[model samples]
Target: MTRAPNEDAIWVALVDDYDVVVKGVATMLDPYRDRVLVAELDTDRPVKDDVDIALYDSFAQPESDQEQIKVLLANPRARKVVVYTWNFHPELVEAARALGTHGYLSKALPARDLVAALEAVHAGEIVFSDPPSRMRTPTSQDWPGRQEGLTDREAEILALITQGKNNADICEVTYLAPNTVKSYVRNLYRKIEVDSRTQAVVWGVRHGFLPDHHRIDHWRGGP
Candidate 1:
């Protein structure tokens, strides 16, 4: 589908069996009229054009699992999808990211907040979890995102590690297991050639990956 650059168009599509959710959003965006064009999709029909953002309500009868989500994400313009569901599973969040979704806003957040989320994703920044996440810090030697080329999830875990949390803590916050966090750390260390946390911190700081304003002490379980 072709999108015209003439208008600051935010083509939004709603994939949900529940009509109320779609209607509610339509009513909410009613005031913002021409700024956003909302498309309410019934499962039977094909998504008309390449929309800028798509909202999927996973709890609906037809359900939208990873596989279904994978299909929806095939559209190049549907990069900034905001998913809503009854469950707040971190694994689901990981899955959505893997499927190319830029944000995951819960249905529980106020209706108005949903607009803010759509606005945020449309602005080109990612919103994985609501209420900005507080992750544990990893060492300087193994900074986040610049590993010997770790996967996106690995980079995410590394960023959490640098926030100063222990493996168990990371698991609790991310809904991952302590052992899994350890495994990621060990693998990342090996890939990045970092021996210890101290070395990771030193190297990270040197490379500017560890911002000066952010200290690692708090991430290590300090208050």
Candidate 2:
């Protein structure tokens, strides 16, 4: 995927099931077309030859997303496969990298940074966004559900549950095992006076516990 000294453009392919996003990203990158060439592959068939990199946007994927990476890897033209996603959990980044993903970039990155990441990947660099450290001790401010006496971990789990993630999904993001997640869910439910996921979600909504702005920045036309 190396370009000659005179060659400045790096060919890229946007892979996603949503046509609107593909088109939207294409438009966003139009300003940098000379530097990052959006390949003319068929929209119906995202994987194709002559692509230097494949940017897979995991918008609403399940917990088991390795198969998605494998599918992109199977494409001979996708010399480098990158996962651009809103899910920037440390655990998810490590999992994607373990599967040989060249880059695990956050969707919140600006267009220029995204292009830089692709170029870095093409140059044989393993790129990943710096995920928040789970080891950091949480202060009262860290717990959005502090008034309810929910621990930092419990608050995080509740936020994910509000976003419709199951135990497996929560495990992937939090790096917690299934049993640990279940235990946390049980504890949080009791703390919040909820017995089921449905009640938890309702509580989260009523208390204004939505996914953080950083995670949803892409939708609001931010970097």
Candidate 3:
């Protein structure tokens, strides 16, 4: 049965760089409007609205050094920050926790579950299902580029490139200078034997790094 929204709804802000994705998520939460009062809709900007939680969706975005999370956490308007993305890699989860994310949700979650997670997080609970702890096992499966001779950071950058993020986008998320990003791109091309972004993306998709997983197939344990 559908539970009625709480009388004291949690104020939320959906933050992302894509308007369509942000607005789409907002629409999905519309049914639970009574439970989650979406107070702000922003695209990669400092959240100005006072909200209980800031949901940052890494939709079509590259994996970075959790810089954006820091930005969100620094903003006084948002009391807590949650990452809603398809990057279920174990390293990303550790990064999120290290950055102090209240919750880390996979994009595959249904709206109902997402709502419940938001409610729990607002109620002072940490929620996470992606990257099950076991996946963190010291094995090759944990690293996407282990066989391909790419460092974790390189693989991360390559993953972003596969998502069609340009140098500026990667730099912004990874907190790297433009020139440094260019260097990474050059190194990735050399390591992956791809001369251009197109070739690199092709390699990435074939290597299971581009299309983020929907479920935690490599998880080890824990919530």
Q: Is candidate 1 or candidate 2 better by lDDT?
A: 2
After superposition on all C-alphas, the RMSD of every candidate to the true structure, in Å, is: 17.7, 10.3, 12.2
Instruction: Give per-residue CA lDDT, model 3, range 1-223, as digits (tens).
Output: 1223564988887765544345667777888888897754432333334678988776445453376677777777678889986556666788889888999986667778889999999999999866443222112112466577775457668878878888888876666689878887898789889888888989987886654332111111211
Q: Could you estimate the TM-score for every candidate?
A: 0.49, 0.56, 0.57
Model with the higher lDDT, candidate 1 or 3: 3
Error of 2 at 102 (Å): 0.8
Q: After TM-score superposition, what is the CA distance of residue 170 in candidate 2 from its true location, in Å?
A: 7.6
Regions more than 4 Å wrong, model 2: 1-7, 40-48, 132-223
Q: How accurate locally, in lDDT, is each candidate?
A: 0.56, 0.67, 0.68
Model 3 alpha-carbon drift over 4 Å, by segment: 1-7, 42-47, 131-223
Q: How would you encode candidate 2's per-residue C-alpha lDDT over 42-88 as one tens digit per residue?
A: 53332324667888765434353677777667656668888976566
Whole-structure CA lDDT of model 3 = 0.68
Q: Highest lDDT: give the candidate number.
A: 3
> Once all C-alphas are superposed, what RMSD does model 1 give against the true structure?
17.7
